[model samples]
Target: MTTSASPSPVLSPEHLARAYSYSAYRQLITTLMAEGKTTGTTQSEALTAYAQLNIQRMERLDKQVQVQPELLAAVQGLQQRYVWLVLTEGWCGDAAQIVPVLEKIAQASQGRITTHYLLRDENLDLMDRYLTNGGRSIPKLIVLRADTLHEVAQWGPRPAAAQELFQAMKAAGATHEEFAEKLHGWYAKDKTHHTQQELLRLINEMS
Candidate 1:
């Protein structure tokens, strides 16, 4: 006689919530401000700008964004718990756009997922371990098993389509402001659909 495989166990909300290294969203903003204060000491224009930009991004993300229904549904379907350790800095425009969405995904997953934020500068060793094209990129998401914290899968900086577009624009020598305008517009139009679709694919592959 043929036997059916048993269903996987689902974690309770308490267990699920505990599985992630939770951070208050405001903490990220505070950390960025601190980084700005410290790094601004060097009198670097780029570093100072990064800090200021990230602060602005964090404030907007905290106030305005919402997770779409499809993302919520996708997050809810995960079969196992994961600790999503994200390497990011506040000044990262991509992080500003993406982090809030990630926060939403974790909330939707019940106990199946939790997100922890690590500043890229603060976690250089770990960031080097997951470099994009030999450069340390911010907002890299590393998925780990909740029980062992072993690496499972990793995703980052931006969605595939956006990455492709940005690379093309860079190759064509578009200005940073031009790139930002196009990218933010694309993100607004897409509304995390591409991000959600890509993440769902990754989860399914790892599962």
Candidate 2:
């Protein structure tokens, strides 16, 4: 009598569309633009549109497409570690792109994903303690194995945004076309990296 598990999120399209569109996505655009030396919402709309375009392409992929083999193994290993908590803002594009596929992977592995939100308006403690690298990016995934005193991973503690995406997508067995489309699309628009949590996820997915 084994019960089949669903993905941790169990998301609905309408719900995801709204949350990703207005929340995680918009914030990601704001952050990417702010990463530059200048600071202003002067081109906010353009950034939003650009980010949305890339996300939309991914969402259009048939959700039923089998989870990639590499991604499946990673999900299994992470699940064994205990509930992996994903702390992200709803408006982040990284959250939108990376999380959805991870969600897909988790579903296949018996649904062991846990997530939280760290909005700019509230809850910066975890970021201060865990992700002290730079601006606490959304989708800053944190993996905790319970036996350790410290957290597992933080995103973008380095350079080369495209490589991060390539690695993550590659882990999921995402095709060169899939990775290239998402990577170049964001790169052309200017972008950032996945957190350590997500970086592991990318590797796990690619396996």
Best by lDDT: 1
TM-score of each: 0.76, 0.46
Candidate 1 per-residue C-alpha lDDT over 143-207 given as tens digits, one digit per residue, 9 for 90 to 100 = 77787666777887799999998899989999988988898898878877887778777776666
Clashing pairs in 1: 16-111, 54-90
RMSD of 1: 7.6
- Clash count list over all predictions: 2, 18
Q: Model 2 misses residue 121 by how many Å?
A: 3.7
Query: What lDDT does the true structure give each of the candidates?
Result: 0.69, 0.44
Candidate 2: segments with Cα more than 4 A from true spot: 1-58, 61-66, 77-81, 117-120, 130-133, 146-150, 156-160, 163-207
lDDT of 2 by residue, 2-48 (tens): 11223232222332233332335345545664553111223355445
